[model samples]
Target: MRPFLFLGTRAEDLAADGEYDAVLRFSGLAERDLRRVRLERDELPPLDLDDWSGIVLGGGPYNVSDPDDLKSPAQRRAEARLADLAEQVVDADFPFLGACYGIGTLGRLRGGAVDRTFAEPIGAVTVTLTDAGRTDPLTADLPGSFDVFLGHKEAVSALPGGAVLLATAPSCPVQAFRIGTRVYATQFHPELDVDALCTRIEVYRHHGYFEPAAAEAVKAAARTATVTEPTRLLARFVELFARR
Candidate 1:
């Protein structure tokens, strides 16, 4: 089996590693089978889809829907690179799964509306699977409703062109979606646990997902969340694409 490519976009050392570790844990990929790349510090190579089993994109502090002037140089570069990759991935229907930031990047790339109107606070939320989600191979085994961790400043306002809505929450309508059967995106962090959320809350305190004064409360709330179901989506992505 070819190695899976994991792209992460976090500048902070601990935050970046935490994202990678989550993907590694949920996907059940060995160190050798998973090739992790920090997009915040590295250039995106020409993605030859055949060279990798699939691509996994992790959450980040950058928001794609932000105004041009507010975007940093690194964010701009990452967005451009991801847009280019999204085109290729969609055109070829390549195997891919994007979490958090993935929804904004790929959703916007595919002509969907992504905005801050549906932003969710940092915590766990109940997400119900749609009829399509119930039958979709990636989500079929998942419970009809389950909890997942999510914190974002922007979300998909509607389904992207040619995308299927898989799961949804009251806070954000488009919680999870799939494109061309092989490509998937989720607003929630499928790989996160309480410890992981605490780490992120600490690392990203000033990034405005929540007020600094609320950090302790946020961490405490995260501790009480039961979100074991979403990890299955990550494992399912690996199981479906690792050999091909």
Candidate 2:
């Protein structure tokens, strides 16, 4: 079977590694089946969709909506590269799943309004599947409403044009959406668990997702939350898209 590709843009080693591990674990993909590229350190290489089963973009500190002056050179380069890649992925209608930052990339491509208006704090939140979500292959089998971990400074303020709204939350209306049959994005972090969320909360404490002083409290809340449903999306993606 062709391996899946994991693209991440985190600059911090701990957070980056944790994100990869979580995706690997949840997707039930062996290390050899999941090839990871840290976009923070390398440019997105020329991709041939035939070489892989699918692509997964993980969460990161980079916000596509950030002002140009505030973005790092690496962020700028990665964004430009991803912008080009987004076109290809959409044109091919390739299988891709993006969590957190992934929503921005796909959302922007479809002319969705990505902004800070729907930012969610670090914690678990209830996500209700839309009628479309309940019928879509990726999310169809899941409960109508379930808890998921999410913490982002920006989210899709308006639904992307021609994109199906899959999930919605009171804090963020555009919790998840799909473009074409094979492309997906979520405002929440599907790969996170208690430990992963705590690690991110600590690593990004100063990055302003929340009050730095409340980091421990935030972690404590995550520790007690029951979040076990979202990972199914990853497993289902692999199940539905893996090729022989």
Candidate 3:
């Protein structure tokens, strides 16, 4: 079977690897079936969509809506590469699933608004499916409202043209969306479980998702969260697109 590609942007070693492991676990993919790419440490190559079954984008510390003057050199480069790739992916209607940071990237690429208007604090929150979401193959089986791990400084204020809104929350309207029938994006970390959320809370304590003093509280909340439904989306993506 052709392997799926996982593009990640975490610069820290432990956080990066942990994210990869979480993806693999939630997607139910073995190492041999998933090719991981660290966008922080390497440049995106000329991609040929036919070579991989699908693409999965992981969350990162970079906020696409940040001012140009505030963006680090690394963030600039990574964003540029992802912007180019987003065009190709969308034009082809390729199979893609972007989490957190991916939503901001795809939202901006499609000429939609992405800003801090709907920033959510760290921890699990209720995500409710819209009518469209209840019928979409990726979210059809999910409960109408379920808990998901999310913490983002920026969110897709409005979905792009021709995109279908899926899950939503009071704090953030565009919790999930789909472009055409295949490409998907979510403002939450569907790849995270309790342990994974705890790990991220500790690793990103100083990255400004919240006050450092609140890290313990965030981790404690993560430990108690019953976030099983969101992970099913990861498995569903793989099951629907993985090459046989």
Query: What does candidate 3's lDDT look like per residue over 1-244, in tens digits?
Result: 8899999999988889999998899889998888998988798899989999999999989999999999988889999999888888899999999999989889986569999999999888999999999999999999999999999999998779889999999989999999988999999998988888888888998999999999998888778888889989889998898775
Better of 2 and 3 by TM-score: 2
Model 1 residue 168 distance off true place after TM-score fit, in angstroms = 0.6
User: How far in Å is the alpha carbon of 210 misplaced in model 3?
Assistant: 1.2
Model 2 alpha-carbon drift over 4 Å, by segment: none
Best by lDDT: 2
lDDT ranking, best first: 2, 3, 1
Per-residue alpha-carbon lDDT of model 2 for 1-244, expressed as tens digits?
Answer: 9999999999999999999999999999998999999998997789999999999999899998899999999999999988888889889999999999898888887667888898888999999999999999999999999999999888898777799999998889999999999999999999998888999999999999898999999998898899989999999999999998
Model 1 poorest 10 in a row by lDDT: 104-113
C-alpha lDDT of all candidate models, in order: 0.90, 0.92, 0.91
lDDT of 2: 0.92
* Per-prediction backbone clash count: 0, 0, 0
